[model samples]
Target: MIPAAHAPTPARRLTVEQVLTGRLVQPLFQPIVDLTTGMVVGLEALARGPAGTVLEFPDRLFAAAIDAGCLGALDLLCSERSLECAIAATTPPPLLFTNAEPAVLDQPLSPHLIELVGGGLPFRQVVEFTERALSAVPGSMLRIAGQTQRWGNGLALDDVGVDPMSLAFLPLVEPEVIKLDMSLLRDPDGDHTRSVCAVVRAEADRTGALVVAEGIETPGDLDTARLLGAQWGQGWLFGRPAGIEQRHRYDASAADLLRPARPGFHERSERAYDCAVDAATPSVATRAEVVAALSRLRDVVAAHDTAVVVMSSADTGLPGVALSLAELASSGRPVIVLDQPATTEFVVAAIAPGRGCAVGLRTSNVLELVTVDDLPTVAVMARALLNRHR
Candidate 1:
């Protein structure tokens, strides 16, 4: 356990509690302007804490929330407050952009939040998330991505070019707004910049999604934003963040609703249990086929260091199955080859958080295989099995 002296101070802890329970944080809106007409298209609501405290700034505010183990609560509180403020504005903007923490994507929200989703905000709400937690919390992220679509809210990937995972999971995220990291525009001549631009352009071309360049403080930065294919932009060049109640609200044409979250996820319909991309009747696999599938599973175990395996008891008799399981176990992954043969006989491997998995079910035949892929379904199935045994 951590020492008391090392813990957050009494005053700091009290500040976090006061901020969350009392909803004392302030919401500041920064306009997202259209580059062509220089018109306000949307407003991104940023949260600030109470005055004269360490929590007044966001960096310290969120860090304090994280230390208190109430980051999720703070996130929900901020979102709720932001939504309420946007709707209460004299003239509601067309789009309201708000931040969402990646780790909170899967947790249940309060009834107030659910009701808010049902009622819909004054404007089409766009929730922004960073790819920083994509690998750390993928199961929740993927489910929320699909859920956000079902909720009729737009999704934005912020600080996209700062990490490789951003580009790697771009397809999975399928965001409507790509908020390029500020650094990309500040120093745009690097090889990495070209790569990011190419990918962003290709994605925009394919999806017809709008690009928003962040931190465009100067005319030069505005030019850089245009060169990067940004149609919408946010920075001091447009306007500083001002509160809704403040008299600094600008008048611009109401922008249309941003694109809805794209389809291709199965969880939106199936919810918690069924996560299959396609539910096809299981088919039998011959000895050669079973061996080949096991070989692939072995490779998956090798590649994904944290992947866990749940093998069918029947598959234990297959050629080299014992050796493969031994190798997987020696690699220190939590592997289980069931001893009892139920109606299903399959070899399943899943990485925690559902980043990747290999799933193949089996039956009375050598294997009652349905499919194999890196879909989140395998992760869901593996988790269900793990729970049942526990």
Candidate 2:
């Protein structure tokens, strides 16, 4: 429809062959932090071309690779280089997140992608699958996810909500991390965005997965993400992607997820239980019933010198629970998670990741576990077990 002279030209960049032969692809790391404590939880490895080149940015680099029918090769190069760079980085963190195209995952690896990742690398790896890749080869995604998990690595669903197919693929892949697309939060008032977050929150709650908000550029973006149930976040607002020399610094001690409670924490947990508390359950079929049960149970626990607070889980999912638990646990508070007997497996998986002096109990079996004649005995035993672990 247009003249030959007016035809659109593709951007000039390194050819796929050139990039592979020249090794022009470099890995840049970006910190994904726990917003509540400003702790650097993980670093996502991003691919960048040589400075001053058309492919300097990753989008441009991948666009060229897609046009040249060499996207797989580029993805492989990026993965390998990311591992190399991460290993060489000064004081590498515990988790190194990397990206992989679906096609690359489908192909048989010479050295094997897992080998490159697990071969004496000290850090746990998270392989993020792009939206396009998830949409195209869901079967491969599931296979790769299982393979990675088997190796003790993590799997992330990248750019969630960018494609309609992502939702369909989610249950099948069942990734450990979900990176929400930034566009969803670009406009805070968008009903569609809020609805998407609500859905993600529920899914994460049901699956016990972590939520990471991507593309946070401003304070508002971070705030909205926090409100929408994302405990971990990544964006330029924290720090731009950079080489190891420019890696973002964080106060690792600020996060107390792995910290042990002090010796006298039992009295503190009992004190916290006595204060005002809130409760929430998003998955429960009847909200009123759960609230009433928690209310009565709170009274019983309080009688034994243990304060109880029941935070609502209606809006935020497990992340909401985790964030709440982190705050409570950091202050030496003990949390008791009560769930229906049938849902014990799901409840355990979801709440196990939270940082707190906590115990999970099935509602119907509570009496069986402890003598029903002495309800106060339950609280005493809980506090004793928590203290023993501490």
Candidate 3:
């Protein structure tokens, strides 16, 4: 049997409150070096709780915040501190990389930050979002990506290999930099690693997006990063993440190396196509046919761990759809069912980046299937529908 997850201890909850209220979390900067030139190209701000505390480790600190239902608050605190700490460093940063938890990407910034936006930030900021969130919450990811660009910062897809589904989303995210997970560095020659490297290289080749590899402690690991076509790398081999008190020297060429990819960040999305569904298209199959086809689509998409399904709660009575949704949700895909209208009814639809949506409705299908004209937009619309319903 699956065990229940643990909740944060009262002590941990108190630690979180103190950490936020007192601004006790320390920000550490790790140098991202250019592999070829061995220059400090960027500094990624790493956060830590007060030294020697139970919540000193970031993983533990975030887990506690999540359990305490304060992850959004903590995420904002980290992002704001990361930027401010980097700006106040002894040396000016060429590029400042700040991470935002997907949950908090949509939340409003602090008033101080809002005012800072008007005055303009002092450094080039790159916002990193995890690849898992790209697949888990495509709609939220897209909206935040747009807002991030509007704020004049770069967007990065972090831990790219952790979620294979994210490879399909590269076109949609169009990140300025692709940060590879350390697992790829440990076994760069493995089949999974090779496949991920190929996909990342393809995106980089086509779009000129910069690639930075993590967990590089050895010169041999540096070679592996180059083999993966990574232009920049970060890990202990260069230097472990350090506090502002530590004096770190950076090369003037750091921004020059990454500037070419900046345009891709500010450009419009690459995939362009219409996703509107017309009910009278006359191609939609009968209810049974749609159920069988969507079942097949579910089996395929579930393997990729992609697709977010949304439906009206009142429509689950359809013969095969409810069972299919159960399987989809079990596979760890999102399946949001909104409250049903008094007289409204629809069938099932599954929208994902990989395969075009499948299934059509008799009257008003929950999410109608469509061709690959533009699957990402359909997924966003699906999420927007759920948000509106909420």
Candidate 4:
């Protein structure tokens, strides 16, 4: 029998008192370097909780904050801590990249922003609005965008290609900076994500805005971002997040540390995609009804390729949104997400093709374009296209 994957240890939850006390949330900085000059142009502040705590990690930290109904409070604290840290730095970079959620934006400008306006800030400030939330409320975002701009702070649309709604609001927000989502670089052979990156570059050029590529974890990703017209990048390859005291201590030549891509990475990636298509036995059903069939469908796919599984839209976020993205990244098997017409296109657009992902095409709201009348035919076509590309 195949060994089961180890389950993660449960995180120790953080109480609202700890959050309000400002004793648990610690702000760490990650450098954003200029691709052409290899100089650190800015630092993005990331939040972490005290060591050995459940909230020590960022995803868990924010998740707990959300659960406790203190998301806005946490955001404000992060902003305050980030600026305080930057001010404490002996020679902080000229740009400080911080974040403000939609909830925080709907209210008056963050007090940290007001503090910057009081003449102590020695550099330009950037306030990033992650598009995942902004996409749902365009009107509130527009108002906040205007409010930030009026405060003399640069605006950034974070995770540009990850959410389809970001695309629709791009022209409307006209942000001074657009951050290309790192998911775009995950699949070496995925043409769609690359095409979207190119489109983002073209749009940035047209608007006279700079494009910052987030998550440049590998040398290949760095090179790809440069070729795709990214002027700036942030990720572990440059430096891991650190306190202000150690922020400037990273290796200036960290880009040189990018190991050569393994000889068969591309071939293996393509083969994985081909296997997913060949393994799937498609079914016809509505989004709501698909949940009941997921177990059987997962078994069918696993019988052919044990790594793959089928998931319904409802299954998504039953845990957390980040968990879905993590599944997309880790599962060697293709995760075919079944959803209604409105979400199918967005999910498909967000996924990298070579990472074992394919959206079951929907016609109207009921039937799949590829799996309606036959399943084998769709598999055959998918295999043919994938093999041809290979």
Candidate 5:
């Protein structure tokens, strides 16, 4: 006979049976912003227990669920809640990042869950994989790597730069985004951390993947992230987790969030001028013009050290440049050609074609100027110049 005061409290274990019965798990959103633009690019879905429950912490809840062999059910529930909440909410379209375990990737995603998410949400929805946790599962990591690409879902490698395992996975998986751990940015000078970050940046550039530096606590950390070429940044420096209503009310524009604390007179003037310019000239250049200019410039630069090609526009901006044969023969420095009139203080150096075409010896270093319709001309000139120089 046990006394009433000494009655035993049963162990509160969340089992698979209980989870399968549709125990609701609410998802909270934390914003991920572009540091340069200051716009909320996406929201990371965080799991939470139902209202008025003792189990509140997502970490604890998830761990318990895993131990009870209810991970699949828990994962499905979280996904369903996140998709439902996102579609039902009034917030603007943003990329939704959901945490996924490696094991879950091999299993077929629930049709109900897919239907909810696929109804309106775009495939830009990112599935963030925990590097350390994924490594532990057998054949799960490879399965996830294959499925993410096949499903056309964006893959994100989270907690990178801290685990050596991430180094191998990064090149193999080639995720859409790589999230650098906050610890690496905390003390950038710490043993090989800077080097590791450099390697990560290079890999990201090569793969055309965006870099997100996480755990930015101070302005210094933000600066470090920017220096390391992180396009997007997340941390306490931005905003913490808040309700959708609260976040919606808060302004997330670049001008609002990135306003200088104490701007100088010149800075203020520049901002005003920039705003006016942006408003006045919205469609500056067409994509075609931009691509043509870049292609011509790349070819010209490859040929000589001081080549020049002018655009056929009214303004006649410096559209292309390269090194001249004489300049290359003398010095290795590449020279840029300017189109605008020389100021009183500065003189524009001229490039004159050599006389008597001695074949390879004097194949006219000056390449053909590229026009809007002259992409082939630029390529031909580039090849000729390279052959002569070589």
Candidate 6:
């Protein structure tokens, strides 16, 4: 373990008069990166020490800040200092993420403070709001939300899956991003975490919020998060939190970080037609022939890291269609039947032909599969089909 000196100290009890002096404020930075690309995205501003004490964790420091009635001042100071430091560095400004208690946000900071930092630095920044603190001041949530929106800084709802109370604030705050805590992701099969993640994902989809799975520690954790639809990920698996002066350069070119967790289906969907044209034999109509076509198509999709699979089959009226596994199931086809030769045409028609339902498509699926190359054309085709049938 790192020495205790590196850890943050809790604030000594101080009078409200002492709080305004801002003497106790010191900001530390924890780097956030793109898990897929391993590129440093930005830093999370964490509070460090008050002159003397033995506390080292950010959580304790923040709690003491609240108790000392200096949380607002501390938050503002951290935001200002963190941004200034990032600008001085040669690295391109990544989005600076900071935590703001709802109580702090409810208090109005001089517009000049926001203007000063924003004017001097690149405006790519996100302020994460702690859900527990927000819940404590329920009546003022909307006001805080409006202020954050007006400040031109993006808002993120943090600690999403840990507390049940977070669900109540989702509609009221309408944050631009939602961060799922690592604890929730520990067990991929845990119903509570999965259910909460599903709800959070749905809210993100509805509001166009970016879902970030925070505190990722292992490859398994990363995989589970991606499978559950988190577009962005952060954790020890990516990088650990280093001190403010530390210049950490994340190598963004690592393919594992950039590659989608499920590449096979998405890649196949993108080049479904191409794979079909190249791999399928003309005279074959057996189950093995169809399975081989699917397998080859899966390989093509995997190469591109896509999530949807399209195949051409001779069974149904629609010879060519894309079918997501979910759609195939919902179409009332038995799993056995779906694996049978006759169901291939129906599956393709449902998914590829842009059938009546938008059942199986997901945003993560789109982001993983749709590249600059052929996304526009594929999108046009999908939309045309949706519109034509609607």
Q: lDDT (CA) for every model shown?
A: 0.67, 0.57, 0.66, 0.56, 0.52, 0.50
Order candidates by TM-score, high to low.
3, 1, 2, 4, 5, 6
Two-way TM-score contest, 4 vs 6, winner: 4
- Candidate 5 pairs with clashing backbones: 304-323, 305-322, 305-323, 305-324, 306-322, 306-323, 306-324, 307-322
- TM values, all candidates: 0.71, 0.59, 0.71, 0.58, 0.57, 0.54
Prediction-by-prediction clash tally: 3, 11, 1, 2, 8, 19
The superposed Cα distance between candidate 1 and the true structure at residue 177, in angstroms, equals 1.3
Model 3 clashing residue pairs (backbone): 347-365
Better of 5 and 6 by lDDT: 5
Worst 10 residues of 5 by lDDT: 354-363
For model 1, the local distance difference test gives 0.67
Across 1-390, the per-residue lDDT of candidate 6 in tens digits comes to: 868999765645544334336444456667666656666656777665544543335566667668777777766766665666566656634567777666665567656466765474553556677876543543344444444545455667898877654653454445667788877788667987877777777667656777788878888887887877787778777666655567767443322222122112111223223222232222324334444444443343333221232222334322223433443333432111122222222223222111111111111212111111222233222222222211
Global CA lDDT of candidate 4, please? 0.56
lDDT of residue 250 for candidate 6: 47
Clashes of 1: 3
How many pairs of residues collide in model 4?
A: 2
Clashing pairs in 1: 361-368, 362-368, 363-368
- For residues 68-95, write the lDDT of model 1, one tens digit per residue: 9999889888888888888888877777
The lDDT of model 3 is 0.66
Winner by TM-score between candidate 6 and candidate 1:
1
User: Which is the leading candidate under lDDT?
Assistant: 1
Cα displacement (Å) at residue 67, model 2: 3.5
Candidate 3 has its poorest 10 consecutive residues by lDDT at 266-275
Q: Which of the predicted structures, 1 or 3, would earn the higher lDDT when compared with the native? A: 1
Order of models, best lDDT first: 1, 3, 2, 4, 5, 6
